[model samples]
Target: MRVVSRLSRVPLPALAVASLVLMTVALTLVFYVAPNDADQGFSQRIFYFHVSIAFTAYACFAAGAWKALRHLWKRDPGADLESYVAVHQGVIFGTLVLLTGSIWAKISWGHWWLWGEDELVLFLVLFLFYCAYFMLRFSVDPGPQRANFSAVYALFGVVLIPVSFLAIRIAKSFVHPEVFTLHGPNFGGWILVTYCVAQAALLLLAYTLYRVELTGKRLDARIRELRFA
Candidate 1:
């Protein structure tokens, strides 16, 4: 309880500053310290940022689902709005995943888009589904029903994550005869450290953005209340 209270009271500016510093350090490590892949050469550097963004997108969706569950089950105030904001962030990062992955694919295979890439295809499906979530949310009046509906939809996305991963695994046997491996058996040392740093940077960046968005939403609501009062 004390830890939670302290965390809640921490200034957003301080948090943002910390995140910026950490991300800067991580990016430095990625570009300067990480060794070039012996196989893919310089192009392999893209994997650090691309994979990190994908994982962050997954984290955002999971957070949104958890917030949605809180809204539905615990009736936590502001949980619905928080959930929506998290999902919005997820979509933004997911779009980045598509763009970065496409660039990486083109670099590796001389094609911008590959029809047989299971991970890419699965991400596309999830992206489309979550995009519709916003449309569905705004189509209804803002109230308990809207909250309930959005919560249910967000929950469905959680279930879809594992199912989609499983489907991708199954597709590898047929659609993709050759397995795609990002890291080699020799992946370690500075390469591992740099990858971990990059991953942390992305997660921190995502959380920082989420906090900023949530703060904006709260401020908007407060302004509306003041205007009405």
Candidate 2:
């Protein structure tokens, strides 16, 4: 029971501090330590963080969906909250992907945007879809009904990831026949170190944010209980 209770809660401020440290280390390494790839030059460096972040975001959403499944399937009381926190983090990183992808597109193709980039396009659709998840969450009153709907919708979002990727790939064929391939910069010892630091930092930062947001929500719930009591 003690272990369960501890598992149910997280130390938010400490996690936040650790996340900050990791991010700082990562950025420093990315700029100073990592070497540019010979083939892709400077732009190739972006892939180390960009693609990693994208994959991380996907992992988070998938995690949320799994938790949601547990919540619905096993009736785990903690599952819904855990799922919500994970989804929230996923959306934040997903936004980062769009921003970074746009920048990368400009750097690579001399355009601020390109729909032919399957990853970028796929993220845009996902961002919109998940944004609606929050909307649907708030619009409906809080109860089992809300939880049920959110869980089911989260499941849908997970399915949409691959479907959206396929859609973008197919759309790109007619939309932009010329496929612009992207290759990351050639990195040396320092650059490689920096990218690893950055990736770790980003992961930590995501977890920190998740913990903080979850804590705030839990406090709010507690306060509501007190007031109602």
Candidate 3:
């Protein structure tokens, strides 16, 4: 497999500092600026970060799947690493989705979990599916073959997203008599601005984390070669 001689030359400290500032500001907006939702009240506050993160996680997974496809079809070496890191971030944020979703469910329904909540139920399946991704990663010896297999499986995950969502929706027929809306702040005025800022900040943070982790892993590979050479 081919390797990159050097990673991109962006300043690490600057990236970290910028992401910290963004996170701080975004959290403030999420809690203080966004008005109390009429339907869900205080619990609706969690929706900002929770939904943003969930959407971001989906983006990451889609990105990973795209890279995986490139790796498999085009034989692009760097795609493998990029695909791995993206999926890794997807898994992290997916876990957060489940965590925050559970919190919201508890606040609203007095239960930590509800199988009937379609979005939450979908995330639960995604969470389990992606968790197994790590198992697949660890079980394989690192090589082109491992990369190829991971790529193929990641593609499967993307396909599974819609399938799982449909399955959850179908299951809801027997689970609940009426659908309960997951209330969110109206997309107007300051609420709109807050959601946009929060989303931008979260996406920037995900990118920063992805770059740093990718760089670190690449450096580790270089170090191993130096030590053994």
TM-score of model number 1: 0.92
Tens digits of per-residue lDDT, candidate 3, 87-184, equal 99998988899999899889998999988788788888988998898899889999988898899999999999999999888878877868777655
Record all residue pairs in model 3 with backbone atoms less than 3 Å apart, i.e. clashing: none
Task: Compare the candidates by lDDT and give the number of the best one.
Answer: 1
- lDDT per residue for candidate 2 within 63-115, as digits (tens), equals 78998999899999868887888999999899999999999889878998897
- For candidate 1, the lDDT comes to 0.87
lDDT value, residue 103 of candidate 1: 93
Q: lDDT (CA) for every model shown?
A: 0.87, 0.83, 0.86
Model 2 steric clash total: 9
Worst 10 residues of 2 by lDDT: 1-10
Candidate 1: where is the Cα deviation over 4 Å? 1-7, 178-185
Q: Report residue 197 deviation for candidate 3 (angstroms).
A: 0.9
